[model samples]
Target chain A: MRFWILLQRDVLVAWRKKSNIYQPLVFQLLIVTMFPLGLGAGAQTLQKIAPAVVWILALISTLITLENIFKDDYEDGSLALYTLSGMSLPVAVIAKAAAHWLTTGLPVIIFAPVIAVLLHLPASAYGILMLSLLIATPIFSLLGTVGSALIMNLKNGGMLLSVLIMPLLAPVLIFGAGAVLETTLGNTPVGHITLLAGCFVLSLTLAPLAAAAAIKVNLE
Target chain B: MNKIVKFYHEMGSPPSFYRITGHWLKPLLILALLLTVYGLIDGLFFAPPDYQQGDSYRIMFVHVPAAWMSMFIYFIIGVSGIIAFVWRMKVAEAVMMASAPIGALFTALTLLTGMLWGKPMWGTYWDWDARMTSELILLFLYIGVMGIYSAYDDDPRKAARLAALVAIIGLINLPIIRYSVEWWTSIHQGASISIMGGNSGIKEWSMLRPLLVMALATKFYYLYSMLHRARSYLLRTEQNKSWVSKQFIEN
Candidate 1:
């Protein structure tokens, strides 16, 4: 009820801010493009490194999106207003996380295949790559919310957000990248996907509570 | 029970903790020194080497414990951070601050020993293997928490609270480090069923006994050092207070 409205409000705000939506996409594209240029234009070389490059770029892009999650609203006192609006702060936090995933994370997934092709990722592995990223990126977004909430009011919040969040995202990176690599090698990606999906489910269930608690602490 | 509660209350106060537990520091320090010496001597020289790995396997006695403590300390930081976040408990935050450096130290040791062992056994010093990579990330996570705590210029309470948040967030890596081999088809070998099941196999009782002693000793060393560091942090943070100042002058 209230959560959906809040989620809608978040989506509306994000839609109105085009740069906010496009910056990470552009960054992801730039990172994906640089690898081919740097490593030479050999298809074999690109294929070899595609999984790592794609996952790393995805990670950096996700990290970049995290900075704006709570910082803008907290700075503008919208968070305070939301708190005073008689809505559950936890629910509001979860709604913002969902909106963040839809706007920021979903674009990365949609754009990943294009980058995948550019990196010479096999047409065969595309299904597994997309599936794994679809499952993995949301967990990154959800976990990033906790880090963002923690540093929401800090000076140079964006850099601090990256340092605080990257290590926590390591497992997702490993499993997600491993899944893609497994597909590349003609091995079963099922095990990697299962572990990643498990991680995603666990992070989704737990991260909102942690982020909500962090926001409360920041408010105090 | 009442007396124990009273004792806890007294110890909960930073000044009292320093005054009361301060004397045990030296003895505990000496005991830790002695136990470490004994464990190293026994582990390095006397224990029969593994049938498969030979001398390189002895590195496990050091590497395994250090890895265990790294994960153990991170859990302490996370659990204590929860308490501090939920209840605003000052002592818990103090304990967390104390645990961070020690955790970092153990994490470094784990990596160092694992690399040493790996070079001899795996023929490589480094691999993107699950356990090794996850452990590396754990070290970075510790550094992040400690760095954030020190970077802040304002109220220690606020800084501690923020660091607590970082600790809680960073805890996501702990399980990953612990179960990396199980969760993924890692290059690292899986945990032996015997160790996982708490069964001692063909290993001599003499060897197992020393390892257990060393593990217990390391646990106590962590406690003693954490208490010492916490007391020092409390003294620094509370230095301007009358109670701390009076206690310092009296001592």
Candidate 2:
């Protein structure tokens, strides 16, 4: 199908730029390292706040890369061609968001355990933290597509994209962090996990349509 | 029904909308001013002090009404946004864009007044209470809407449509955000006043009457401000149209 081909093409294109993959990883690790430096490296304090810290780092690092989702294709005029190619725009949006997650979000999840060690997050929370990120980061990428599409034509859209999407992302941050926090508190994280999955499903269904609309608007 | 449909059709024209809203603006402003003056006087001095908090609770007169306006204006923005996006009506786009700043203003006022009252009663200026957090997010949503509109300065039509999309999305997310925050935790007190009349929010008629008056006043103020802004927006964007030029030349 064209969807898989488009997805593959995008992933391959991003993979060629090796720095794009490592930049967010390095950024996430650097931020993960800062908490200990600033918070005095106390294990108890770090343990208590580790989940939140990890989530916040993921959020910021992801934000750094979101504008790139549409900017490169937009600049090359390929986005317009994609639109006119008879491919479903929302389908193209999904392909782009998937590529985004594969490149950026997946790497963060893979490295989160190593980052978790720096903050002294307990062994018990490791699974829940990863599970929450697994469900939550795709929502981030989905929402990012909408934000990126909305301002793809602008010159300084990076910061504006964050302002536009962060409030919408607040619920995800809350439920994702809450799940990990619940795990640390020795409670059932099932409730938080379910709510997060709900959010993911909702964003998955709606965000692509919204992004497609925004892309059309920008193209006009 | 025919008259209503006719009016709707006529109002779709920017010139007609500007003219009709021009007629309503002065009266709406006067009514809003009169009601606000009376509401403040009656609520501040005449309404009995709360049995527990005494006079400190009076801030609710302003705070609660602004909070209501904030949410109400956002509802209007979302409805107008749907109209703009689906129908591509210029007036709907103008109205949607006009409502954002006013909504943000009211949301900020609500937070400010709430914080001022909180300091006296709860001994802190801010808390992460569910309502407070959700209200804060509402303010950000307003700012985001406005930010997108201004970012597309070169293409006003595109700006309006894109901003409408953002508003529509935010409207859908508002409930989700509120629910997630509530699920996180709630320290704020539950609603005291209900329209269904089953519970006690404000038992005193004197207090309730003025609060209602203030609420009405804020509604009028919102209409006045939104129309004023939309009229200006229409004039600026439609400057090349004959009606816009004629109105300017005649005035």
Candidate 3:
């Protein structure tokens, strides 16, 4: 009950501070746009590199948004207040991570096809690309939450968060990219998407508790 | 026995570890240097050239040990990381930090030696072979751990905890590296020695003996190097403590 309320509060806060959500989206768009320009607008080249470019940009954007996840709240002492609240801290972490996914990741998924079309990816690849991103982005958000919670109190948190999360994100990227590639190649993408969903579910169940524990440790 | 246990506990203390073990590093370093020289010489010259591979098979002396150590060190790092995460043992975290750079170096060596061997054997210096790619991923994981730790300017303990998490997550790549040939159509050769079955190829006892010695020497070298770096980590982290200051004065 309180978790839903807290999640709503977080979403409202993020909505009010639209820049936090828009910055990463803009960065993702800019990066995805750069490929066509740099590679000379060839539809074939764009189609060939589209999946990798989208996956990599998605990774970078998720990582960039992670920098502010806990840092701003911790600096403002909102985390302490949340800790002092009667609700379970892990529940609170889950709520916050959920809200983060809604604001940052959902938009990325919705916007992926626009970027996909720009890259000249066929309509056939769209469903798998969207599905993989839909499943995989939350995993990135949740994993990024853990990294953010762990390093929330550190100096220069941005760079550290990137290094810590990038390798962990490799498996997600591999499977997600694999799905897109399979779709592009006219192969069955259901298996790869299932693997991506499995990864997302695994991360969703485990990462919030880890992030909550990390936050508690950092606070101490 | 209690007193010896206390001594061992004290040895885990940074001051005592540095005082007692730091001096022994030089001999081990010299031994590692000598073994490396001898292994290279013996492998390059005296070991009879392979009938199938001719002189190029000599790369195995370096390549095999490096590849083995890369996996071996990840296991060590993961185990130590688990200890550090669960027990909050500073020494275990120190061991992990020490092992990482060495592991990365060995992984790099594996890649280099694989490329060198691949050129003559596979006709290309690089291949997207499963084993080679996974080995590359291992190197990236090592870099990620080390880079994250170094990026944390303050609170190394926190950094260690986070790095430990990263290490555990990266363990997925290890099995992939080992079983890559079986799982995928890898250009790399299958295992020559299998515990589950008899040797796939007969290696002469004479060649095996030196290879085994070189492997043991490399293992010892990793141990000695890990202890040295762990001691250094202890010193750096405990520099402001009275025990460290007192030990330095006493020495």
Candidate 4:
């Protein structure tokens, strides 16, 4: 009950501010367009770089907004009264991460297939690409919450969040990009996707707990 | 053992820590410098050059130790971080916070020297060898700890605790990241240039011996620098406290 309420409040907050959803989407689209211009519109070239390019752009998009996950609730004193509201901090962190993934991770996963097609990513790899994104992005959101909770006190948090989370995100990026790269090279992407899912499961269980601890520390 | 433990307990006091570390600093620094000089002279001149790469391979003495220290320091940070978070040990917090830049330095040196080594061997300065990529990410982790520490500078103790948490998190993530990176690199390229290819990464005893000496030298350097940095950190953060004021008067 508390989880739904907090999750709903976050979603509602994001909905009221249309830019929260819209800006990242636009950023994703702009990066997709910029690649061809920068890398010179060679279909073969773009196709070759497409898997990494698209996945990295998705990572950056998530990074750009990750700081806001805990900032607003923290600033508004909601997180301070979290224990008083009879909600466990870890459960609340899970709810917050879910809301963030719904807003940020979903759009990127849904949109990655389209960008993959535009960048001439092999048609055979599309399913694996989307599948990888579907598995990996939630972990990204979860890890971001872990990073966010630790640095929520910072007024300018964006850069610190990247440095903290980017290294942690490395495996996700590798497996996510590798799944597509594997399929492009005519191999099964099962290994890559399996690893991605493993990362997801691990982060799912651990990230919220870590974020909860971090939030408690910062609030106190 | 009891005496050592008691000594540690006494050293945990800020004034004692400052005084003891100050007394040890010169000896530690001199020991590190002497070992480093001997290791360099022996490793560079006395140790036989690689038949394949010749004199250029000597960079490995410095590069490998830096690489080792880069990883080793993270473990120290991780242990210190756990201590800080679980027990709220002020000394552990100081150690964790003070270690970041030194860790970053070693990580950067590992990359810079690896690149220099790579240009001759791999025919390119940067090709994302598994180790190099991992070191680069490790550098980011160090910078992240430092950045978070500075961001919380107004509350120095809290900053250390928070930075310690970040280090612990990064430590947990390091292996997963290393696996993905190594797997990804092998998929894209092959196994990296082995340090001792023919010897299967265990070099001839002649080569191995000085490398060990250099590694020992680096350990001393780390101890020297860590003690110095932790002392300065203690002083700066504890400046308003009476112990620090007394030290100022004596100085």
Top model number, TM-score: 2
RMSD in Å for model 3: 3.9
- Local accuracy of candidate 1 as per-residue lDDT tens digits, B1-251: 99999998887677777788888888787877788888888888898877766777777777777888998999999998888777777778889999999999999999998888778776788765666767888888888888778756466887788888788767755666457544554432444222212434536876676677677667878988998998888888888889788876786
DockQ of 4: 0.84
TM-scores for all predictions? 0.88, 0.97, 0.87, 0.96
The digit string of per-residue lDDT tens for model 1 on A7-38 reads 99899999998788888889988877778778
Taking chain B only, the TM-score of every model is 0.88, 0.95, 0.85, 0.94
lDDT of every model, 2 decimals: 0.81, 0.90, 0.78, 0.87
Which residue segments of model 1 deviate by more than 4 Å? Answer: A1-5, B48-58, B169-173, B187-202
DockQ of each: 0.48, 0.87, 0.30, 0.84
Displacement of residue B30 (Cα, Å) in model 2 is 0.7
> What stretches of model 3 exceed 4 Å from their correct place?
B1-11, B15-27, B172-202
Residue lDDT tens for model 3, B122-222: 78898766667678878877987787677664778787887876676567545533443333332124443221123344378655555666776688789
Q: Write the per-residue lDDT of candidate 2 for residues A1-220, one digit (tens) a residue.
A: 7799889989999899989989988998877778878888889999999999899888888889999799889999888777788999999999999999999999989988988898899999999999999999999999999999998888999888998998889989988998998889888899889999999999999999999999888887
* Candidate 2 ranges with C-alpha deviation above 4 Å: B187-199
Candidate 4, clashing residue pairs?
A: none
Candidate 4 per-residue lDDT over residues A91-150, each given as its tens digit: 998999999999989988888887888899989888888888899889999999999998
| All models, RMSD in angstroms | 3.2, 2.3, 3.9, 1.6
